[model samples]
Target: MSSSPKNAMLAEHRNIPYVAAGVTNPLQEFDLYVPERRNTLDTRPPPLICFVHGGAWRSEDKAEHAGLARRLAAHTNFPVAVSNYRLTTASTPIRHPAHAEDLLAFLHFLLTWSGPHTSTPTPPYDPTRLYLIGHSCSAHMLTSIFLQPLDPASDSASRSPTPSRSPSPPPSPVPTPDSLIPSPALLAATRAVIMSEGIYDIDGLLVTYPAYKTWFIAPTFGRLRSYAPWNTASYRSRPGAEHLNWLILHSKGIPW
Candidate 1:
């Protein structure tokens, strides 16, 4: 799925009631679309559903996906939080590492803001469930979480000496994917994660299809490896329906 429709959806359903992650940067802000449960005097902790928007990493707001949050909340009875990321129109290229950094920051905040749970429920909230859900162009949300563990903040040393003259070399698998985000202990605490119309096979998709290369994939991914989030190894780690309560729901009839 492309990032344009995701932007359109965000524009429509931004009128719900919930808390917001105040401006982390000059350009970014976040909102939480709490289900009707937050309205009552409920004692239980509701399950968390985190939504990440996609604008090729440059566009889309947290409020953009609030409708889907409301839908999920109403349907499944979960707490849904949406985040706005930093982006600028001038020289508006979102690039690679920047998007990864933005996502990692959001994830770190959520994990810190709300931790684990125990028991069943006190009154209205449910304790047995804790999940992460991302869809559309935001599929990179889950990808970033999995890839962060393996990459450094910036691989400046890897930059090509002659940028305009020659292209950078392909990425090597040296750092490995687990070196970045959470340790083994922390990973176990995560309940489940979902990606809709995932960009999991991004790097492969770029190389596999000539259409993407001519479009924006070549520039965005930056050579083969080069710390791009869409790399095969990083994307493969994502949990499917069986593994991490993950579900990659296509709109049906889409080629995928």
Candidate 2:
């Protein structure tokens, strides 16, 4: 068995907290790999490549994929960040949307990140150009972040045969929070999304692999009668989704 080559011309910054340390879950951290610049005169900041690891949304950590991040940074000559999110467990009992929400928070942190704030002497990353790569369940989380349900009522109304009527305004005029929603700037800055072996449709997945329900779905989603709301395929694409370059990859040989 031959081992793959390693990239030596890269600097690794491990376990940098995207969220406030000690204030939030310890898993809300990321590892950054910055490749050595070959040309000093270029002066242009390359796009940052962010990798979201997958272990059925219940396992895996950023530290496990350090080698992959180094290889990506070396090949692309770009900064690579492998992020960690809270996992669903019997003890923790974290469910869907929580994992996706963490990813959103991490994105916000990366978009507004300043190198001076960290003691690691981090290299400046270009916020204008960000490429997201998600493997397995992370892909579902990434899709959920960008393609949220715009209006549940409207979707239900559209399914009905009755004539559509104007929706009555809320009596209180209270505004819905945008905390989970990705800002326009964040959406615009995301240049592309690469989904590898992603679970796009929860219902479809269950039909194909019934065993997955016991393996991860039930643990990650809880006892939901219908998985429609959590299905990434059913979500409406956000404004910048049409503009984003999407690449989907799947391995036929891999049996779930």
Candidate 3:
């Protein structure tokens, strides 16, 4: 007897390392969900849905969101990838750009991945057609990847390195110049971004919700002397930024 639609099976690949295993951090991994095809004759590759989770940028894992990924894959008949990234911790503090860097690495991996399945003859999803969905802080992370620096002068000034009296350990290496800057190919391939309750205006958020400062802002981004560097609302638009479609969702009750 044929299986019921409610009980349909999905092909799930778990803990697939996007970065070089053991060489880099272990959090740079993702879970992929592929729905079983009902039409045998349709051979066209489907678009990829890359989901970025939200947990104040300090909690949650890809494994925790497998159900969402499976549902997305099954509903849309498209492959879905739920990704993990380095999170801020008390013991080993992680800050801005680290989380976004890990995400960019995953994107690079997906763009160049060669389907090397030993058992199945099925091809991989089309990398050129990517639909990104990010929630909460994830919205900030995704924007950090695609948006240009808000102020080139200030950005360069900040990197000039001010003199300090007290000796301190070197700041964790910032992402390379090209790492945060999305390439033309990447921008072209990204079809759309859907941001839900996104934290775009950092300063605005802090002005309204003072509790966020203690909850996640300080922990994830350090003391906020100025929120300009972390704010996505003021980011400059590049050449390719206009081409991609964007959908921003916010609750009517909450001011976003």
Candidate 4:
């Protein structure tokens, strides 16, 4: 007995949240949109597409993307998920890797079908078919986290240097891979990746656009006392990336 129906199943699962590092804030949540219709003969869980929205690393909310998620599911007849992550600002400073770790946590929760944030049972997903779709800052975050291999022993939050005068330590690191971390196997099965208007070279941007350093980079990356740079070069040779067929989208108006 499977939850995913090959035939047209008109259903849209919404506001399905997932836990990340014990944070109960609504920002550590996600909304899932599943196609209302499917190919009847194909008795398989539809492909899964996870979306991470972009807000220049600190401004937008996931709720804003609800229409996009619904459209993606309806048009493609696939399971589409949009997630939220902690944003960084002078007052609420969240640094490098925390955003990505939350995404990783969401993926694990999706694969396992149970997490502290999720209140209802999730539908079955196709383990063999997955896709990651991210925009702008989220594209960068996804690139950073997924480009590196999972070190079961390492904690991204702890590895991040705390701000010199911040009041709270960063949120806890995402769960260590037990028998559940899904990337290795899921990545192998990824059908495609769609990155829209992504920032590929961080250092280059800093060097070329001096104003951006103080305006955007400083608040996002500079907040961290220490961090290893992950750039386009690092993304090219990432593990499991070799198999992915990528569609990189960019606006012609922006000259980067």
Q: TM-score winner among the candidates? A: 3
RMSD of 4: 6.9
The residue-by-residue lDDT of candidate 1 on 131-170, one tens digit each, is: 6666654666465555333234454432332222237433
Could you tell me every candidate's TM-score relative to the true structure? 0.61, 0.82, 0.84, 0.73
Query: Which model is ahead, 1 or 4, in terms of TM-score?
Result: 4
lDDT (Cα) of model 2:
0.74
* Model 2 Cα shift for residue 182 (angstroms): 0.5
* Candidate 1 residue spans exceeding 4 A from truth: 1-27, 38-42, 87-94, 114-129, 147-180, 183-186, 207-209, 223-230, 233-243, 251-256
By TM-score, is 3 or 4 better?
Answer: 3
Give the TM-score (vs. native) of candidate 2.
0.82
Q: Number of clashing pairs, model 1?
A: 5
Cα error, candidate 2, residue 62 (Å): 1.0
Query: Among all windows of ten consecutive residues in candidate 2, which has the lowest summed lDDT?
Result: 168-177
Q: Write the per-residue lDDT of candidate 3 for residues 42-107, one digit (tens) a residue.
A: 888888999999988889998789788988987998989889999987776787778888888888
Better of 1 and 2 by TM-score: 2
Q: Candidate 2: misplaced stretches above 4 Å?
A: 1-8, 21-25, 116-123, 156-179, 253-256
| Runs off by more than 4 Å, candidate 4 | 1-10, 20-23, 114-124, 149-182, 223-228
By lDDT, highest first, what's the ranking?
A: 3, 2, 4, 1
User: Model 3: runs farther than 4 Å from truth?
Assistant: 1-8, 24-26, 119-123, 154-178
